[model samples]
Target: MKQLTFLLLVLLLPSCSVEDDSAPLFIEPIYVNNPTFKLKLDIIYVLPNEKYAKSKYNIDESKYLDYLNGCFFNRHDIGIVLGESRTLVNPELYDLKDDRGNESAIFERETKGTCKPDRLNMYIIPRTNTIAIAGLGVTQRTLITDEFLFKTTSPHEIGHSLGLHHLDVDGNIMSRVKPYLRKEFNSEQVSELIQQIITINNR
Candidate 1:
């Protein structure tokens, strides 16, 4: 009986070791070696009329493009290129109250007659009701506040438009904390974004 009990314990130990080995030890941030996809963007800056504001937000378009490339294209071979861009004046839409269950109506009004299926529709607005919620991305449209125009917010929201979800990883592009540290996407997310780009291109 003692010999049989010892043998059973040894058998169970091997099974447990197998389970541990099956678990993944690490997740790669980039799986694609050569990516040839570049998403196009139609950026629209919505500003208030002269009565409210006279100049556009202080944004450096070149720097913004560099950020996008550094965060996604340089690392994973996928990036975004600016296509058509314009500015509009509408005080109400400029000061966007995007949250509080008012997102759909507000977004629709702001994007009316300007939404394109092939290009990502990005609206640069004055701000939302709260500073914490800086942007919104649904389908292929992304709305960004002027305050976060030059931060990692665009790529973060664009990730959502590409079907990626928020991650708890601090240094991940999809994370909600430490905006400066958020730059990389996990391998799974890279794979998903690649698929999404293919689907969008085919559509």
Candidate 2:
């Protein structure tokens, strides 16, 4: 009887061990394939007229697009074609006090009148001093930036559009502070962005 009991216990232990080993561990999904999506650039100017504002900035849209392609999209295998290019003149957006006013609120108000549902909207503004911002995965995805913006600013804002948040580490595209020179996205960020792009495409 004792020997039979010991044999039964031994048999149960192996099954219990196997069950423990088979339990699922919660792990995030990682994507290895490159995902592509459409991106639009909307150069917004708060001035008397669009032509006057263009002269003030003197920005070459095509050249800027090419630079962005090299720095971000092409490197990540994310194909971003130039979409709608428009100039907006909003006194309210321009008049809003930078230090006292809210950038997000200003963006929301301006984009509500001009946002397109199909593509990412990048709003480039020329100002002496203003805050730059980006909407994270919102339907009215928008980026509000100034003429003096760093080269990495656009890509960083676009990363936010793809649902990426700021990282505390330096030399990362998603760093919280400025002087962001790093243009590379980490694997996890890429995977998460890919997932977001997939969901957006599916919809």
Candidate 3:
């Protein structure tokens, strides 16, 4: 009886839903004939700074841009891009605290490489003097890989800095939750991103 009941629950759960690959991504159709947004996104990549100097990852100085470009340009088509070797590209930083009553780092990496003015809501860090990718929890460039982890991670972190949050809290590349798992946004993600780009660029 328990076996049958378990089987039924699994079948009925939302997790059992089928992926609708054929469905067009649900972009809000800015229909911009000419649209504008109050925010501007600046894309930045990780540098081999003290932050990454301590990690097990190693970023390939050569191949870094390939994935970064693919992730952002392929998705949104608009946003300012900063080189990985550069220091905090955007000069905005803020301080914050955590649940343990201990003050936490906030502004350093929360913005990855983008700044949204008043809407900086996703992955925020508080320690560093510059807004960076720390919220991605990948501080060192050495800990990165040419493929997989580091490649996707770089862009994902930058996205958070732009104002994106966890689509899936667990390891989802787009998640804002801690102990993160690098999850990539699906086909649907591209649409949401494009909407913003068109709105921004068309402005």
Taking all chains together, each candidate's TM-score versus the true structure is 0.70, 0.67, 0.37
Task: Estimate, for each residue in 1-203, the C-alpha lDDT of model 1 and write its tens digit.
Answer: 64334321111000000011122213223334444887777777776675533245666776676666764655777867787777767666665543444654566676777778887788787654333356776677777776665555667677777777766465676665445576677788888887887887787
- Give a tens-digit lDDT track for model 2, residues 1-203: 64334321111000001011122222222232333554444555445354464556667777776666665666666655567666677756554445334655566667686865556666665543343232212343545445433356566566776677665344556654333345466776777766766666565
lDDT per prediction? 0.62, 0.51, 0.33
Give Cα distance to truth, residue 163, candidate 2, Å.
Answer: 1.5
On lDDT, the leading prediction is: 1
In candidate 3, what residue range of length 10 has the lowest lDDT sum? 11-20
TM-score of 1: 0.70
The sequence of per-residue lDDT tens digits that candidate 3 reaches over residues 1-203 is 64334321111111101111112222221122112222232223333334533122333433434344444343434333332232232222322222222212333344434433323122222223222223332221111112333334445544543334445444444533332344355445555555544454454
Better of 1 and 2 by lDDT: 1
How should the candidates be ordered by TM-score, best one leading?
1, 2, 3
Q: Which RMSD values do the candidates have, in order? A: 13.0, 16.3, 12.6
Q: Kindly report which residue stretches of model 3 are placed more than 4 angstroms away from their true locations once superposed.
A: 1-62, 70-133, 136-151, 169-171, 176-183
